[model samples]
Target: MQGRSIPAPNDWAAQFWSPIVGAEAQATRETVAMYDMTALKRLEVTGPGAAAFLERLCTGKVAKSVGSVTYTLLLDHDGGIRSDITVARLARDRFQVGANGNLDLDWFSRHLPADGTVQVRDITPGTCCIGLWGPLARKVLQPLTDEDFSNEGLKYFRAKRAYIGSVPVTAMRLSYVGELGWELYTTADQGLKLWDTLWQAAKPLGGVIAGRGAFNSLRLEKGYRSFGTDMTYEHDPYEAGVGFAVKLDKDDFIGKAALQRRKSEVRRKLTCLTIDDPHSVVMGKEPVYDGGRAVGYVTSAAYGYTIGKGIAYAWLPAELAVPGTPVRIGYFDQRIEAVVAEEPLFDPTMSRLRG
Candidate 1:
């Protein structure tokens, strides 16, 4: 929202504030890059039944201490993933959910109990979010705020109330781009001030305003899945490569029984593919072939500037999902060669995120 004045084209209804996608992507990796993530949906759930209700709906352990953030999935009765969300426990009976879209709000509303023990509110219209990420993120942010921005002060997956200059904010130490930074959230009225404060601090430190184009490329390089694109209500958590987020040992959830049966019977998986030709780029929805036999289709694709290759994620047979398995992608009139590779190609150890 702060970069709204920048003259650039729109991607996913948000401005491509920076025209050079590769440079923006590089800046996010080398230094700090500010991203306008205000378009993302935000929701607040509170009342006596909030924890119990969310636990019953999400697959991960949700009833944790305040300031704890849990990445979880909302699954259908059939064990299919409906949405992947981050649930931040703000209080014993209050939570701020980073959800997919309006569909998630509708789903949560539809499942509310009639006893009036839980309440869900859409807070996106009144709030704004800015994602500041990179190795220099903490350096640029610590100087402007009195709050401790060190790794020890605010560890990963934690959230706390803090101030940036005169602007009050809720800082969540999480990054979708696999960097060390916080997703700063605040009231819409203070959005401009928050943006100005961050911009002035980061500009001299080589921080740039990144857009969704770079965000997509960076996320793919990190092997982060995008809901509604990389997966949907038709795919299970295991096949979607996010089985780690599901805690079967925890209390029963909506799809626990189905997952218990489906976990060991995974037939297909969302596989990562790297185009053999670094210059051959293909957008999403392309058909994939296993030696002339069409086996699956691409869900998402982007040129990974950091890795210097064209990356694509596709649904393939379990046997073909193995690393080094060769495949081909049908891009218009050409069949480009590709191979299955390990995920999180960039910083699989998560050193950057933990740093």
Candidate 2:
């Protein structure tokens, strides 16, 4: 969100970005964008039972001290992820869990206890989310808000309340782009107004309106997992390279036992591979081979700007999962050679984030 002006979605914004402003237009090697996400819903769980319920339902540790947010996974009893969620602890007893898309209020309501202390609210329409990313994203956003961007405080996985052009907003200092950015959440009625204000402020910093396609490429470059694409209930956390989200040491959670049993039961693991031939593009579920024999399949593939090649995530057998292993990913009818690179194809050192 730097070095370019942010445009207010007027008749122009709705027309420019499509009826859905923040959604994806297409999914390709060069770009990964949002198509549709309303099938999933935004559900808010608050009250005394909120934290305790989330602790039992998710794969990550939700019991942070205060004002903390963490990426988590909702799993079935078998340890397979149902939906990836970002759990934000608003208070000791209140928390907000965000998912990909639609009607999740019903999804969470079905599991809540009949006890009146637990209140489930569907406030999707009342709230809106805008993401600011890119290498210069921080530079763009730093000047627009009055929050402390100090080194020791307000670091990653941290959230702070701030103002954007005088309107109240909750800025979560996180990014799917793997850069130091924030996801600004505010009221829906003022969504367009705030977007324009952010853009106006970020214009001098070179911020541009980041479409979903660009966001896709950014996340793919970071080797970040996408729900239902790279991860699903069919796959466990460990296999998807989301081991950090799962806390095996905890006493109990929905899939604790299953996760423990499958800790070492991984038949394949998530990996990053760069196309040997940049011209040859690989698509999802494309067969991956170790000299003709199928060892795995591409789960998510994209052309990364940072790496200057087609980098992707795949599920490969354990024998060929080590870093520096040679492999081939099939594209069209031909095979595109690749190497088993480390887990984050971009910013592996996390310098972009720390900066």
- Model 2 TM-score? 0.85
Residue lDDT tens for model 2, 248-335:
7775888889888999888888888876554565657888989989878888875565566667788888778898998988766777
Q: What shift in Å separates residue 74 of candidate 2 from its native position after superposition?
A: 1.1
* Candidate 1: 10-residue stretch with minimal lDDT: 1-10
Q: Estimate each model's TM-score.
A: 0.94, 0.85
Model 1, total clashes: 0
Candidate 2 regions with alpha-carbon error over 4 angstroms:
1-41, 102-107
Best by TM-score: 1
- Report lDDT (Cα) of residue 315, candidate 1: 98
